[model samples]
Target: YSIFMCLLMSCISGIGRATALALARCGANVTAVTRTQTDLDSLVQECPSISPVCVDLADWDATDAALQNIGTIDLLVNNAARTSLQPFLEVTQDQFDQTFSVNVKSVLHVSQIVARGMKARGSGGSIVNVSSQASQCALRDHAVYCASKGAVDTLTKVMALELGPFQIRVNAVNPTVVMTEMGHLAWSDPEKSKKMTSRIPLGRFAEVEDVVNTILFLLSDKSNMINGITLPVDGGFLAC
Candidate 1:
C-alpha cells in the first residue's frame, strides 16, 4: 500500500478540514498546510491520519520549503482561498491583493512545485482547484471574491492543458455555500440563511460530503478522462 501525498493548502477548519478527512479516508497520507501552527496542531488531531505542515501559502519561500519536505505528491488540492465580501465601491487595494495572493498565486506556487515531482517521475498526478459558484454566477457584494475565483477557474483549464502531455489531469470543483463551521457564522441570521437558500433550486446549502465526493472523484483514476472542466457541485445554484 503505497502512500499518496495529498497537498492541501487549507488546514484546520471549513472545507479544508473536510477535504483532509476525505483524502485520509481514501487511504492517502495527507500533507495538510496552513499558516498558523496552532491551526495545524488542531488539524493533526482532527484528522489523525493527516500529517499537518505549517506554511504560509502566500509566502513563496515558505510554500517551497513545505513542498520540498513532501518530496512528491500524488494529488494537489489547491483549496486555499480567502473571501472578502464587500460592495465594489467599498473594496480596498489590500483586499484585492490579499484575495489574489491566496486564491491565485498560492495555487500557482503549490501546483508548480508539485508538478515538477510528478513530471520527473513520469507518473502523472491530479490537481483539484477549489473554485466558487460565484465564478459561474453573480452575487451581491462579491466583486473581489468572484474575480479571484474566476482566475482559479481559468487557471484550472490552463494547467489541465499544459499538464495533459505529462498525463497529469487538472480540474476545478466550484462549490456553493457549504454547511461548515464558517457557514454557520456567515449565515447565522435566519433572514440571510433563508434568502440564500431560496436562491438555490435545491433550497439548501451544499454539505461537506457533496464537495468531498466530487473532489475524491476528480482525484481518483475514475475521472482520468475528465480534464480541464469546472464541475460545479453547487446544488442547482448555477442553474437558477
Candidate 2:
C-alpha cells in the first residue's frame, strides 16, 4: 500500500517531516512531493523509507504526470499550501491568483487524479485536505489566504458527496496557529504568539501532532462514518 504525501516548500522539516515519519512507522511507503530537489534529497535522508518526487504543484501538468507515474494511492494527504499576509488595500492580483492556484486548485487537481485510481481499486481509499481556521474566521492581513481556504472547506464537502458512491472518503483538518516552522515565522515573536494563543481556549498554539492525529483518525477506519466534515483541531479557537 502506498500513501502520497503532497507537501510543498520545506518538506524535510516541520509538520511534513513529522507526518512522513508517522506514516513510515506504519510500514506505508510514502511518496513526498515538493518543489526543490535539494529538499527532496534531504527528505530521503531524513526518512530513508520515503520515496521523493520533486515537482511544483503550481504546475498542473507536472503534478498530474507525477501522480500518474506513482499509481494507485491508498491514501492522499493534500497539505501543500502557501499563505500570503497583506492588507486588503495593498494585496495585489498576483498574490491572490497564486494563493488560490496553490491552495485550492492544486488540491482539486490532485484529489481528482487520485480518486480515479481509488475508484478503480474498488475497495476505495481516503483523502485528507489540510485546511485552516482562517477558512471560517476573519484574520488581519489574510484576505486572499482566508478566501482560498474557505473554498477548500467547501470543496471538501463537495468531494465527499460526489465520491461517497465509490466509498472514497474526503475530509479536512483545520488548525489554528499551528507551530510549524513556517507558522513560527508568522507568529514568532513571543508577544504575537501570546496574543494569538490567548484567543484559544486551550491557551497554546496548535501542535503538529494535534492536526496529524486528526488526519490519521480520518485516514483510519475509525472515521468510516465520517465524511464531508471539516473537523477543527484548533484548540477550541473556532468555538470561541
Candidate 3:
C-alpha cells in the first residue's frame, strides 16, 4: 500500500526530524514541509524517502500552492509551530501573531489542503497533530505556546467530528519534554530539568522515538477506530 505522510513540523526540530527519518526507514514516502531549506540539509541527504518542500506556513496562499499538487496524502502530522518564551506582559504583538500564524493557522490551513485529497479520493486517512501538555497546564513563560496547542486540541476534535463520515481520523499527541537537541538545550538546567521531571512519574524526559512510535501507530490501520482524542505520550506525566 502507498502511504503518503505529510509532516508540517516545527522547523525541522526534534520530533519532526525523528518522525520523518523513522517513517523513511519504515519505507513510507514523506513530504516534509519546512520554512527553510537550511534546516533540512542533513536530513534530506540522510533520508531518501523524504521530499523537502520549503513553504512558509505563515502565508496561506504559499502553503496552499505548495501542498496542492503533492498528490494523495494518507497521513498528516500537523507539527507546525513557533514557540515564544515570554511572560504574559512581555509578549509582543509580532510575537503573538507569528506564533499563532505558524502554530495554529498553519495547522488548520495545511490540514484543509491535505484532507481534501483524502476525502475526494474516498481513501480513509489519519491525521495526528503534535501537541503538548502545556495545552492543558500553563507554563511560566509559555502563555502563547500553550494557547496555540490548546487550539490544536480543539481543532483535532472538530476535524474528527466532521471528517468521520469520510473515514478520516483526527487526533493529537501531547508529549512531555522530549530529549531532542532543542529539548536538551531548553531543559539543560539541572534545577529546571528536575523541577519538570519530578512532576512526571516516569522521572525523565521522553526520547524522540517515543513520540514517533505513537504517531506511526495513530497513522496505521491498528488505530482504525480511534478518533477525536488527544493521546498523551508524556510517560505518565499527565497522569500525575
The segments of candidate 1 whose C-alpha lies over 4 angstroms from its true place after superposition are 1-10
Every candidate's lDDT: 0.82, 0.88, 0.84
Span of ten consecutive residues with least summed lDDT in model 1: 1-10
Residue 12 local lDDT, model 2? 55
- Candidate 1 lDDT by residue in tens digits, 1-240: 123333334455677777787777777877777777787788787777777777778888877776686766878888887878999999999999988999999998888988888899999998889899989787889999999999999999999999999999999999998888878788889898998888788888988888888988998888989999999987787887
Q: Once superposed on the true structure, which residue ranges of model 3 sit more than 4 Å away at CA?
A: 1-13
Deviation from truth (RMSD, Å), model 3: 1.5
Superposition error at 205 for model 1 (Å): 0.7
Candidate 3 lDDT over residue span 103-172, tens digit each:
8888888889888988999987888899998898889989999998999899899999999999999999
Q: Candidate 3's C-alpha lDDT?
A: 0.84
* Per-residue C-alpha lDDT of model 2 across residues 33-126, encoded as one tens digit per residue: 8888998898788778899888889899988787787866999999889987999999999999899889999999989888988998897889
Off by over 4 Å in 2: none
True-structure lDDT of candidate 2? 0.88
